[model samples]
Target: MTETFPASRLWRDIPDLLFPRQCEGCGVDLAGNGTLFCWDCLAALPYLKPPFCARCGDFVAGDVPGDFVCASCARRAPAFDLARSAFRFDGALAEAVRRLKYRAGVWIAPGLGAFLAETWRAVPEALRGRVDFVTPVPLAPERSRERGYNQAGLLAGALARRLRLPCRGVLRRTRGTKTQTKLSAQERRQNVRGAFAVRAPYRAGNRLWSRWFPPVEGKRILLVDDVITTGATVDECARALKAAGAEAVYALSVARGNG
Candidate 1:
């Protein structure tokens, strides 16, 4: 049986409908519309133009081609085999993401997930087959309890459904760390180091490994996150997966921070 929500209950109880819709970036009232942002606001967002670094997905100024890496990526390479993002985190897009992840705007996941799927479709064919399972960057238990949800998990769930892939919780936060936003690049790296652990009893073929044993043998994983800033969190997760014998690990984000 299909359960249906009452129209009045939906409009009155759902925060996205209850509150007057507004542009996440500029806070302009959108009346009783269901869209998160107005048309003008969406058009004004700083969409990532072409000529981006192939490795990190950061915008590149010059006309470079063929698997280019950014200056920062060249200095210290990322742990993940490859990384991709939907947009450069700036202007209205950044504000919308912030609200979705930090301010409890859970209703925005469908739009964000669809945008990510569209971007992933543009990736080279070589990468399309490397992703076996889609997993979100896990949040600490305490933080998840406080937030009532993990935005990355929500995005990953939607993306996995769209891509026809399994969504699994392969990695877990072993220790709580300070918010990466308040830290410098080097500090962010240090903060997330050794912060993640692969969960046990992982399903492998027709067998389940013992809780005391690792089961990430020869698996290809696609790690999902809301945004990539310093790349520290994903790096840590990748390192843990590699240590557990994952064949390959790639990352995807809805946006990449401009810093």
Candidate 2:
């Protein structure tokens, strides 16, 4: 008699066996490559390095005295206390983000999360221990329904798992806002204002999280997102967190728009 495997098990293994593993960035079969990114393509991604702006983590082209903010950030202050980005939103990184956000490439989260964890190691140590909780900027219920899932939430969940930190849905979108695309910088900022609110005294897991985080009053939060354009969305979320007595809020993203 020949041994037989369960039908379900065989079906489950088919995709992995036949498709093999491919580099997420380049779509090349990564069999024995031992990486989700091809060497050349990985080198091409715009990985942000140090000597970046102290406030927004944007690359600073010219030397500036002291811990200075970027020209754009200095001209118009970002609402979040601090911001860090893993990659510049261009080239292969941008394409990967678009695929993940718009094309249902949800499987890309783990790779992106790993990149974020590696990038985050360069963050100032003072801020690392201060982070008490992790929250992703929420999408409006209607938009989330249309998209089937919030990309930011997926990234946040993966990041939280890697960081061994608690992740929660604390901010809720109160209104549907216009897409930021094709909007002026000022208009984009105005559009997202007052669009988000924190659920009062955030509750999760059937328990009251009254004193779970302690820095300002309740918690110091690290907000995660797939990408940040004008920092408007994150700013609004930060305002809500602060209003709810969060000590400090830091925004981190996989990519940044045009900076």
Candidate 3:
């Protein structure tokens, strides 16, 4: 559903205030340069540097050579081959994302997407070239109806545009699950299980699914989201994509939350 948010529309002319102009990385007044963040916030935006887990993209403290997997990943690998994010979800970053998710902070999308683009550019050549389509984690119809906009969808659109790829909604939530926010890591994993399915063609003479986007079979799909807390949601999404014949599925998020 198109979010005709009264607040968003009311302050359309005042772009700075339409969706918060303060720096999400830090509570500072924006420079009014359309960036919505101060230079300091931009510098401190916490890019997830290397020596991390090759599987789940978590930060590894010590020097762990090439393709190293953290102990957590070694125990159990996520469904997606690789998952990455631009920042660790803590302090200002967490607050920033919360604003975007709960509040109508769509303005943060471009900045977040650009970070994902940079991460993608740094991926291995072989893996990078395999990405054929970009998609977002599907929100349940009920939650989407309540929020009037999906934060992941908004992030996917911006990130795909930055990566010069088309954004496609190729997955759909099959069931409504409890919010993963307050759940423990194990609870999170269980909560999202079997919650998603690969979206099929809508066959009512509608171009909603099949006609608009190509089939998922044999394609390298990049799944986008606002955050990766437990790897439960995106893992399920990747499972669905793989079941639908996608050769590989990668997950990207704006931030990563430590459990």
Clashes of each: 0, 2, 0
RMSD (Cα, Å) of model 3: 3.3
Ranking by lDDT: 3, 1, 2
* Candidate 2 lDDT over residue span 36-128, tens digit each: 578878988888766677877777666666676788888877667788899889988898888678766566776788887776667878745
Question: Which tens-of-lDDT digit does each residue in 50-129 have in candidate 3?
Answer: 88788888886777778787787789877798988888886666666776677666677676677788887788886555
- Model 1, residue 106: what's the lDDT? 72
Which residues of candidate 2, in runs, are more than 4 Å off? 1-20, 32-34, 63-66, 202-217
Off by over 4 Å in 3: 1-14, 17-22, 25-31, 202-208
Cα deviation at 63, candidate 1, in Å, is: 3.5
Candidate 3 residue pairs in backbone clash = none
Number of the top-ranking candidate, with lDDT as the measure: 3
Note the Cα lDDT for every prediction shown: 0.78, 0.76, 0.79
Worst 10 residues of 2 by lDDT: 1-10
Report the Cα lDDT for candidate 3: 0.79
What value does the lDDT take at residue 19 in candidate 2? 46
